[model samples]
Target: MKLKRTMAILMAGVTCAGALAGCGGSGSKDTGSAASNSGGLTELTFVMASRDEFMSSIEEAMVAEAEPLGYKIVSQDAQNDSSKQIQYIETAVNGGAEAVICLPVDADGTQSLIDAVGEKNLVFVNRPPTNYSELAADNVTYVGSNEDTSGYYQGEYLANYFKQKGQKEVKYLMIQGTLGQVSTTKRSEGVIKALKDNGINPVEASAPVVADYDRPTAQEMIQPLLTSGKEFDCIIANNDAMALGAIEACKDAGVEINFPIVGIDCTADGAKAVQDGDMAMTVFQNPVGQGKGAVIAADNMINGKKLGTGMEELGALDTSGKDYSDSIFWIPFEPVTKDNVADYM
Candidate 1:
């Protein structure tokens, strides 16, 4: 398992509201055991960071994959609430869930969750905690693609596209996700770095707007910017929902600027946006891989088996690190430009 990368390429895209795909339904807040099938399947609970399409996909994939592997999976929506997530964790702890796959509301805010998980295995999905490599433990590990890669890819593509057209100092409006989330921070840094490193002077069009990874919010937040006459040649949104929002906003204002917009997730809407030429590109962050991978890791953990042993085909499960306390597994991100958008869809 290796993360072989050219340090030379990829950065930013943001949040998810993926296709209406994947298995499983929204789980009850109740903590109770589902009767075991032919064998005593390990009971698992997934406490989601929020209730959205991407989270739903993760829950669905986990349930689908876990059932055959002699595991029962249930999920809870934290709705971006740390307190609610903690209460659910308390329920999971009391209900005797063999493992908990949590997507916390805040990446850095896990002290309460740590206290609640007790001896149960806590597998974080998608979002990594702040200073993760330093803070992660044997019981608390993360499974996700590198958030920076999406953004970096966006920046790299934009850099190359603009540079090729003999363009310089491309001004961009960055639509950010929730500020404190790990995805937001790393994606922001990574894309900006990619632009600078690629010999492109990416000027900020205006103050970055926080859309909270929602379309309406992005649309509302951007109206004022358009009215202010602040011009931007590109828009790098954290997620496709926001990127699409920017497009609609531009259309509504009847702005002559057909800004090149990029986003993350490569959701159905995002891909269509690319195909229809409403947006430029997006990076594919696979929920199925992440969901199945989490279930596989939990199965190994509960059985007292090695975590990375069976996960070779998914991605290199990086269980090794200097003074490592956790078994982390990383899924890689891929860029989806017009050149390759159809393959992803």
Candidate 2:
């Protein structure tokens, strides 16, 4: 989809839920801000794109971490709609949010919304900017795993694993998310480049199925691909949800081929599947730290403490060229198979 740049793409609104549910008492809890700090209760709004279990867990952990430091958390779920995500951001901006943490649904389109909101009230999660140089102008400080590196590592590991197993040509299929988004674009490029470097020509499917990052839609998309009379040895899923969907599709189609499924995002179910020999490997994205980091940095900024600047202000902040030391922070990636599943778990 062509991302719009005009004002028509900007938005901010709330859905049916006043606040997102499903945050149990499993996160880090504090009695209250040490009781000695002078900062009063700070109100923060988090605008997330969807309701994945991993995202929710991170949200809860963030809430727990923030509450102890005298901060209240208000979250808005955009349901993976770019317009709605922008709208939620607008709402946060208008509502006088001290700071906003967002997981952008449409990576490119939200650049304008971030620009409109200004720097005093913006932080990003999961998705970072393609042009990090412009992040500060739009008021975004992004915190997430490196998509390209993660995908490249997954591809390299899978290829080497198959190579050692006496496989000559490895046929690969990609179940991608929305087109042109930073994550999807980088992940696809990384995977393809890795396969090509290893002398493998991956088969390109006719169309990339976009499930809007939903599991049910991914399941629907995979059922057809699994039975399309095409033989694929490796399935490179953009996320674990899609990986699981493809696995389900394989089971339903009764295909006994020993296909290795690789995915990003180390959720519990994905890890469990790896343990059970269903999935080959996955990248462990540190979702839990997303909210917490944003809040900490925003709080530091508010508290007059110096924070690491983004790529936009690197020269101004760090003349020694250390600001951009590693903009793309990665958690870790474990090549989880039946052998290492127990260790990872």
Candidate 3:
């Protein structure tokens, strides 16, 4: 069943690829009773930052896991606006949602969301709030992979590539996700730390360019750099979309990539890129695991059970060696290179 679900999730990535990038959800804000509906279904609100390629996959998995269990997911997209996200949270709460599952637009604005939810169960998915540890409670928890681990895997792959080539000093271009995101900061810092830890002298080829995790923005941001004839040993990106963008930019500029280009989120296209030798490697941030985990967490919280109750069915959960209180649940990230990319695909 896990293998079948995994394949369905991978297929979802392809299906959701054509979804409008910044489109907001059409969920109505009508007020309703919090009690179970006439069909005996409990509604849980799922508010997303936006329906990007990878996020849409998570949404699909969440819906698949939720429906059969007699829970309805009322999904909303904030279109990357924090204000809209808060508004949606209030609307969900006012509309009698027993729980709210949010992929926050601004991690820093988590307090506002907490205040708006006001005693209802809350499960934060994917992007965790900046103050996650401090804010955790019986009714609130986080479900996602450790962001630092994602980049550390990228660095480990790159470090091994360079060490095998007997190169100690490496210059690289970095394509970053949205600034101010904890994922962006941690992923950027974690890779550098891993390279140094593995005895590699890493130097930036240029100041990192921010692309807000958009492929077209990343392609446009790095095109000039690729054409400028800057000598760099590799390219690093916060996620697969930007890495693919960098690959496209290099191809457009006729630059033969001779070095590693690493990223996170082994989306279907990213795994294919690794298999085809375009992307050196990527980290598999499991959407199926995260989506399932979020639903389980919210359900457990609403029932006054442990936050991680019944999550073991999803597979092993890596807590990153931290003895976190029950308020946090981590889904592990796997590194996908040419040798292992086929397994992910």
Top candidate on TM-score is: 3
Q: Report lDDT (Cα) of residue 248, candidate 2.
A: 84
Off by over 4 Å in 1: 1-41, 133-136, 316-326
lDDT of 2 by residue, 1-345 (tens): 111100010011111111212012111111122112235656777888787797796688578768876787778888877788777777766666656787777676667657656545466777876665444332345556557577786778777877888775677777886677887788778877887788666666445677655567777887887788876677888888888888888888897748788887767888898887888888766555555566664554445333332212211122222122222222233345566556445
Q: Write the per-residue lDDT of candidate 1 for residues 1-345, one digit (tens) a residue.
A: 112211111111121112211102211112233345345876688898778877887787788889888787767888778999999988977776656888888777876787788766677778877755422344565677777577899989999989988887889889999998878888888889999999999899898999999998998898788878777778889999899898888888886546688999878788889988888888878777788878877776666565554566654434333222234566778888788777766
Per lDDT, what order, best first? 3, 1, 2
Position 325, candidate 3: lDDT: 35
lDDT of 1 at 324: 26
Between candidates 1 and 2, name the one with more favorable lDDT: 1
**lDDT (10s digit) by residue, model 3, range 64-176:** 88888678877899998888988999998787777899999889888888888887767889988897553334456678877878899988988999999999989989999
Compared with the true structure, all predictions reach lDDT values of: 0.73, 0.62, 0.78
Candidate 3 or 2, higher lDDT: 3
Models 1 onward score TM values of 0.85, 0.76, 0.88
